[model samples]
Structures are given as C-alpha cells and as structure tokens.
Target: MGRKNAGIKTVCENRKARHDYFIHETYEAGIALQGTEVKSLRAGRANLKDSYASIQNGEIFVENLHISPYDQGNIFNHDPLRRRKLLMHKAEIVKLFAKTREKGFTLVPLKIYFKQGRAKMEIALASGKHNYDKRQDLHEKAAKREIERALKDRQRY
Candidate 1:
C-alpha cells in the first residue's frame, strides 16, 4: 500500500553529505523552530551544506543549520545559524545514542522538508569516507559517463 502522507515538500538538501560519508541509516525528526524561522523555511531560504546533528544531555540538537531570517520580520527575526532542538521518540533517541557512540559514526542531516504542514529533517547515521574512497567514486562515475556516451554515439551511427 502507498504511504498515507507522501506529499513531502523538500526545502533544502545536503548533497555533499552523500559524497563525504557512508550513510548507514536515516531517521525523520521534527524541528523546534521559531515563527520567523518557519516563515523563512517556507520561502526555501535555508542551507544544510555544513549542518549536523548531535545528542547532548539526552536531547538531540542540530547545529550550524542556517535558516535565513524572514525579510519582513524586522527586529523579530531569528538568528540564521542558531542551534535548534530535534524531536524524536525516547526509544529512538536511546538507539541513536548507542550507535553514535561507536567509533567513526556520527549524525548528519541529509535533508530538510515539510511533511503535512510540519517541518522534518532527514538525519543519517554516517561514517566519513577516506580520501581514496572519494577518488574511486569519482573515477567510477567518470567511467560510467564515458560508457553511456559511447553507447549513445553508436546508436546515433
């Protein structure tokens, strides 16, 4: 059966996260945002390039997340790079805590989107990739592209 709430509107995505880390699992968590922050997110004025999530004192918080201030908010605008709390179940938090404690594992924000009028973040359990791994991935991608180009040229002839 199809999902009941499938109309997710993506606000921002961290494409570099996939390239820099090996993502193991993903979880959806709600964000605690202020009024102006919500308005700015709705306008798609957000960046997740260098954002990351961390568990602190039994609660999860996202840091370095940039939700630009609302243009019309005047002095009531929220800080662009303020830390925000993330809402997840207690059981889920415990599980994440255990996993993140392992060596080289971390919580990374993959994307931020609106689901059924509420903003949610897609966070992943990831481990950083080595420099050689990144080079290998780029080489493979280039080889795949060259193969596709050759096939297309042969078909044209």
Candidate 2:
C-alpha cells in the first residue's frame, strides 16, 4: 500500500511568531543541515520558538533555532543552536534585506517542514504588532468564536 499522508510533513511551527508579528510576505528557503541535524529533524525534534532570520554579510542565516541532537549520533552531533545558512536566490535576499532595514520590520521563521525528502523553512517578512493591536486581534478572535458557538446552538435547537 502507498504511504498514508505522503505530502509535506511539518516538523515544527512557531505559533508565538504569528501572535507577535504581522506577516507581510513569506519565502521558502532551504536549510543547510548537517547529517545529525537532518536525522534529528526527521525524528521530529526541532523548535522554531524564538528563532529568527537575518541578513549577514550579504547572506541570510537563521539564529536561535534549536535542533536537538540525534540520539544515536555518537561523536558527530551538531550544535543545537548554531546559526544555519538559508539558501535563497540573490534577488530574493536583496529584497528581504531591504525590507528588514525598515523600522520595525524583521524576518522570522514561521515553520519548518519536509517536502520531497528535503527540509525547508518558511520565513516571513513581518512587522512587530503593538500591544493594542494584539489585544484587538484577541478580541476579534473571541467574537468570532462566540458567533460560531451561537450558530451551533441554534442548529442544535
């Protein structure tokens, strides 16, 4: 039988990133991973929390991304918090760098997943959300939940 759910398998997601930033654009970039790192990722041991992308010396790199070491790896385990290079087109890098230079705009990794056996990261160009903006989003979400609850109750009756 064919493998079930053979599409993209998500390894980890940064939920906090969504709550903290207003994402304007997203880009898919390949990660330069070591052998142990790839093994650990395939085992679903990775975290995107507090991880962010930045332009450094004309290249893009992700920092603070924690990829747990492979349990079976003896002496070649990669560092959990090493800065990893992200592979993207030169033009895309230039655009992203320009946007990040603007006040309050930053680059954050939204998620990490595997596609066609290759690891990929979804990075977004985003702006920080103000406290009031966060509160407003929460209020709107609660309102939508309430409306949905009311509709379900009406159908039940």
Candidate 3:
C-alpha cells in the first residue's frame, strides 16, 4: 500500500520563514486559485519563499505568493504574484487575527501543497527571531551534529 499522503504535491516552501521566525501555532487552509493557477501548480511552478498571510476586513489573504502562468495560456493567464484568499473557519480566523495584532506576532506561509487533490497552504503564527536567538540555535545545532558524528565514529572503532 502507498503512503497516506502520497497524493500530496508540494509546490513550494518558505524555508526562510522557519529560520527567521519562532512558530507558535500552525494551520492548514485552502487556497483560492484560478484555472491557470491550478494548471501551473500541477506543473510544480509556484514560489512561496517570500509569501505571507494577512487579515483584512475580517478576511484572511495570502500576499506575494507567485504562481507562474500556464505555458499554453495567453490572455487567460492570471497574474503571477496575485494576492489570493485563504479559506478558514471563522473561529480560526478570529484567533489568527487576535494573535497577529499582538507585538512581534506575524502570519507566515510555510508551505503550499496539494492535499486530497485540493490546494492548501500551511500558515504559521510566529514571532520574529532576534539575531542572538538565531545564533544560539545555530550553535546548538552544530554541537548536536558534532556529538552525533563522534558517537558514530566511536561505534565504528
């Protein structure tokens, strides 16, 4: 049998968001896409590196998410960097709205993937990581890597 999530296709991921922000809460929301955008995504031509989510007029939207136009589309092609709406429950939206209004909290798009044949976005409630925090994390990771390597070498010996 195949994996449970075998049908999912990851179009893009914002790796920098994880490095720059401390994620607090995460949500999976459906994305609104046009015909050409969907076609482009099926071809794996999307970029979410600099994308983020925002609340406006009691609704949530994703900004700066680039979806390349379909090759066969000309006039029917949608804008590559359009702001798309995210579909979420009212309670979730309200919570996200409240959390983002606080100091240093933000809504970032971590990844975009097709789930169950529908496009979905992974949104994270996060706070910006300071320079010192990032440095400490790097140091910790390096130390862990060194220890793991040492253990492997000792086992081999």
The runs of at least 3 residues in candidate 3 whose Cα sits more than 4 Å from the true structure, single-residue gaps closed, are 1-4
Give the total clashing residue pairs for model 2.
Answer: 0
Tens digits of per-residue lDDT for model 2 on 35-67?
999999999999998899999988999999999
Tens-digit lDDT track for model 1 on 85-132? 999998999999999999999999999999989999999999999999
Per-residue lDDT of 1-157 in model 3, one digit per residue for the tens?
7897788888888898988999998999999899899999989999887788999988999999999999999899999998999999999999999989999999999998999899999999999999999999899999999999999999998
Q: How high is the lDDT of residue 95 in model 3?
A: 90
Q: How far is 14's C-alpha from truth in model 3 (Å)?
A: 0.8
Alpha-carbon lDDT, every model: 0.95, 0.95, 0.93
Q: Compute each candidate's TM-score over C-alphas.
A: 0.93, 0.95, 0.95
Candidate 3: worst-modelled 10 consecutive residues by lDDT:
4-13
Candidate 2 C-alpha error for residue 118, in Å: 0.4
Candidate with top lDDT is 1
Ranking by TM-score: 2, 3, 1
After the best TM-score superposition of candidate 3, give how far the Cα of residue 34 lies from its true spot, in angstroms.
Answer: 0.3
lDDT of 1 at 104: 97
User: Which order, best to worst by lDDT?
Assistant: 1, 2, 3
